[model samples]
Target chain A: MSAQDEGRPIQSSTPDGAAAIGRHAIRTEALSKDFTLHLQGGLRIPVLRDVDLAVAPGECVALAGPSGAGKSTLMRCLYGNYGAGSGHVWVRHDGRDVDITNADAREVRAVRRDTLGYVSQFLRVIPRVPTQQIVAEPLMARGVPREDAMAHAAALLSRLNLPATLHGLPPATFSGGEQQRVNLARGFAPGYPVLLLDEPTASLDAANRDVVVALIAEAKRAGTAIIGIFHDTEVRDRVADRLYEVAPLQDAA
Target chain B: MSALLTAEGLHLHFGKVAALDDVALEIHPGEVVAIVGESGSGKTTLLRVLAGMMAPQAGQVLYAGEDVHAMGEAARRRLMRSDWGFVHQNPRDGLRLRVSAGGNVGERLMAAGARHYGDIRAEATEWLKRVEIDPARIDDMPLQFSGGMQQRLQIARTLVTRPKLVFMDEPTGGLDVSVQARLLDLIRALVAELGLAVLIVTHDIAAARLLAHRMLVMRRGQVVEQGLTDRVLDDPQHPYTQLLVSSVLAA
Candidate 1:
C-alpha cells in the first residue's frame, strides 16, 4: 500500500512487530531529506533521495557507504538537526507515539533531551568543560540534579576505561579514542532509548576499536536501540545486527 | 645491497616517555620494508626521525653515505623536497583539502619550481589515471571525494614527483576492506613500476605480508624481531611478535 493512501500521517505507533516483542523504539517510512546548496547566484542542489530505515529495541543497525553517499546527512535528518523535505520519524515514548519529524523546535529539543541520543563524526566538545561535566550535559538538560548526573557520568567514564585523572580535564586535550568514549558517555547519559552514532571508530586503533564495540554491546544489553554509520567493516561486523547502504546522492540539474 | 638510509642507535623521547630506544634500521634502494607495531610502539616516531621531521637525542642518520644530521638546513630541505615523499596516517594531512585533485597531484612539481602549467596538468592527469581516479573529476575538491579516493589522490600527489624513497604511515588505517585491498594492490604495482624504496608503518600483519619484502616487529620502541616477511610473520620468535601474528592470523 502507498504510504499516503493509509490515511495516516506516515506515522507508525511501533515498527512492524517491534512492540509485540515487548519493546518499541524508532520507526520511519519513506524517510527522505533533500539539501539545497546555496552557491553563488543562488543555485540549489538536491542531495539525499528517498530512503527507508527502522531500528528495533536493542538492535544495532549500521549505515555503510562511500563519502558523499548521504550517510551524514541522513544522520542529521534523524537527529532533527536538519528538516526533512518529506517523510516521518516516529519514536515510541512511555506507551505513546511522537512524530519527531512533525514536532516543533521546542518539542524536538525535548525529545532529544529525554528520548533520543546522537553522536556526530566530528565531536565538538565545549572547551573548558570538564569530562564529567561534558558527559553530564545531557542529563542536566533533562533536569536531573547536577551532583547525581556527575556521579553517573563518572561511573560511565570509569567503566569505559578512561583514566580518573581525565575526569576534571576538558575532552579537547584527550586522545581521539578517549574523546570518542566521552562522546559515547554523553549520548548514553540521559538513558535515551534510541542512539545514533556517526563514524565513532574512524580514528581509533585496533585495541580501542575493540573497546568501543564492547561498549556498544553493553548499551545493547541495556535495551537501547542503536543506528550507526561506520567506515570500518570490522566495526560494523562487531556491532551491527543488520546493515544498510546509503546510495550516492543524485546529481541535480 | 647498498644502504640508502641508515639509523644507528636512535633514541627519541617525549617528555619522560621513551618513544624509541636504541632503534636501528637500514633501507636499501629498490627494497620495500615494513615496520609492524601496535599502538604506542613508536613506529611513527622512527618514521619522523628518518624523514628529518624529528631530531633524536643520541643517534646518527646516514643518507647516501652522508651524516644527515650534520647537513645544513638548506641541504636537508633540498633533500626532502627533491628526494623524499612522505604520506601521513591521514590523507587529509598529506593533501590540501581546498585545492582541486589535479592541483594536489601537481603540488610537488610546483614546489620544485616547475612553472609550466601544461606540463603540470599533463603529469597530474597521468598520475590520477594511474591511481585509478576518473580524470573527469580532476577539478573536484579533495573533500568531495571518498576516503579511499583521497588516499589514492595523495599517493598520486607524492609519486608524481618520482621520489627515490617513500614513507607511508598506516596508509589503509580507516579504509574499508575492499578499498584497502584495492589500495594495497595499487601501491604494490606502483612501487614495483617505479623501483621505489618504501618504508611503511602499519599495524596490520596481513598488510605487511602482502606488501613488504622484509618486516620488522617492534614493541616498547625496540625491534623485537626482524627478517623476511614470511620468516618473521610465519615463524615469529618473540612473545609479542607471536601474539601479534596470532591475532592477525586469527582475525
Candidate 2:
C-alpha cells in the first residue's frame, strides 16, 4: 500500500501534510471511524470523519470533545485499538511512518511494542499476576531482563504512591485508584515515542495525579509525542500543549 | 517470519456434527496462539488435526511448507518426536505413568537418538528443575507425583527435545486454581525463555489472556472470531465472543 502511495502524487489537504509525513512522530491522513451494531440489525454508527491529526516529537495534544463526540474513538484509532473506517493512521516506527490502518498484525504489533503505547482508563487485570509483574511485562516484551524490568516497575509504582506491599500482590484486589496507577506505570514504563492516554488521571487522587503530570512532563522533555484524553482540566492544563476538538457528527441521531 | 505451522480450509465431521468447519490458522515462530471455546467447540479436534494425530477430511496442515497429511507415517512420527510436541489434558496420556520422572523426560531424548545414559539423565534432571519440579524427585515415578507435578513432568518430557512447535490441549485443566496459576506462570516464562511456538486450546479465557498473543474463538467447530488476544477479549465484536467474555466470572 505504501508502495502504491509512493507512485501516486501525494495529495493532502493540510499544506504541511507531505512535509509532516516525513518528520512527524505520528499523524493521520483523512482518517475516519465508525461502528456496526450487529445486534441492532447491523446499524452503522459513524464516529470520526476525515480526522487529519499529527503530533510532533516532544509535544502533547489532548483530545477535547463532548461525551460521545468520538474523543475516545479517535484516540483508539490513533493507537490502532479501533480500525479506521477509511484513510491512513501513520506512525513513525523505527524511523519510518507505518500506516497502522492497513499494516499487517505483526507490523502493527512491532510498532506497538516499540513506538505506540496506550494507557486506557481501566486495567485489564491479568488473573494472579503480581502488580509489579504487570507493569514489568511491557519492558520484558521489549527484551529488558526480568530483574531490571521488575526494578523499573517497582520504582515507578513507588513514584505513583502505590505501597510496596501491594506491588507483590495482584492488582485485582487493589482499589480503583491503585489499579489505575499500575496501568499508568505499565504504560509509562516503556517510554514509548507516541502514547495515547485515555484519561490517565480519572481514578487518581490529587497527589498521584500530580505525579502523573510530572511523569508526562518528564516524558515530553525526553522527546516523546503524546496524545491524551484528560477529563481533569487542571492535569490537562499542566501537561497538554494544546487541545484537538473532536466535533460530533450531525448526520446520525 | 514464515509460519512454523499453517492449516487451511480444515473440515471434519463426527456423524452429523461438524467437528471442524473450514478452520484455518497459522502459527509463527515463538508465538502463542490459543483456541478458546466452550465444551464441544472442537478446539481439541483442531489441536489434534494440527498436530497430525487426527486428519481432517478436507484441508491441509503444513509444517515448514511440507504437507503434514502427505508425509509418510514414519516421517510424521519423527516430526512429532523431534520438531513437534503434544501435551495432553491428562498427563497420564502424555507421560509414561510407570516411568520415573527423569526417565519420562529422558525417553524423548533417547527417541531423538541420544544413546549415552549419563547425558540423557543429566538433560532430564535439568529439565525437571526448569519446570519447577525438585530434581531430587528425578527417580520418583510419575504416579507418585501430584497432579500439578505430573502436568509439569509432561511439559518437561515434551520440551526435552526442544521442539519448535507444541500443541497443548487444556494443559491447566482439572488442577486447583493456585496450582493452575503456578503452572501457567511456569509455561509463560518457559515459552519466553526458549522462544517456542505454542498452540494451546482451552476453555479458560484467563489462561488464554495470560499466555496467548493471538486467539481464535471457536463455536460449533468454526472460527467465529480471531485477533490479538486483548483486542478480542476487551472489545469483542462477534456476539458469541461477547457472550464468552462476559460469561467469565470475575476473579
Q: Which prediction has the highest lDDT against the true structure?
A: 2
How would you class the docking of model 2?
A: incorrect
User: To one decimal place, how large is model 1's interface RMSD in Å?
Assistant: 28.7
Which segments of model 2 are wrong by more than 4 Å?
Answer: A1-20, A40-43, A163-167, A250-253
Alpha-carbon deviation at A177 in model 2, angstroms: 2.7
List clashing residue pairs in candidate 1. none
- Full-model lDDT, candidate 2: 0.87
Q: How does each model score on TM-score?
A: 0.50, 0.89
Alpha-carbon shift of residue B198 in model 1 (angstroms): 0.3
Cα lDDT tens digits for candidate 2, A1-253: 2212211121222223445475589999899887766556767888888899889999999999889999988888787676677898888888667788666555677889999999998887546779999999889999999999999999999999988988999887788898899999999999999988999999888899899999999999999999999999999999999999889987433
lDDT of 2 by residue, B1-251 (tens): 78899899999999999999888888899999899999999999999999888989999999999999899799999998999999999999999988899999999999999999999999999999998899999999999999999999999999989999999999999999989988998888889878899999999998898788888888898888777776677656676777798889976
Local accuracy of candidate 1 as per-residue lDDT tens digits, B5-94: 999999988888888888888888877899998999999888888888888999989999887878878888888777889988799999
- Model 1 C-alpha lDDT per residue in residues A46-102, reported as the tens digit of each score: 556667787888999998777888888778777766556678777766566566665
Per-candidate DockQ values are 0.01, 0.21
Q: Positional deviation of A202 in candidate 1, in angstroms?
A: 43
Worst 10 residues of 1 chain B by lDDT: B230-239
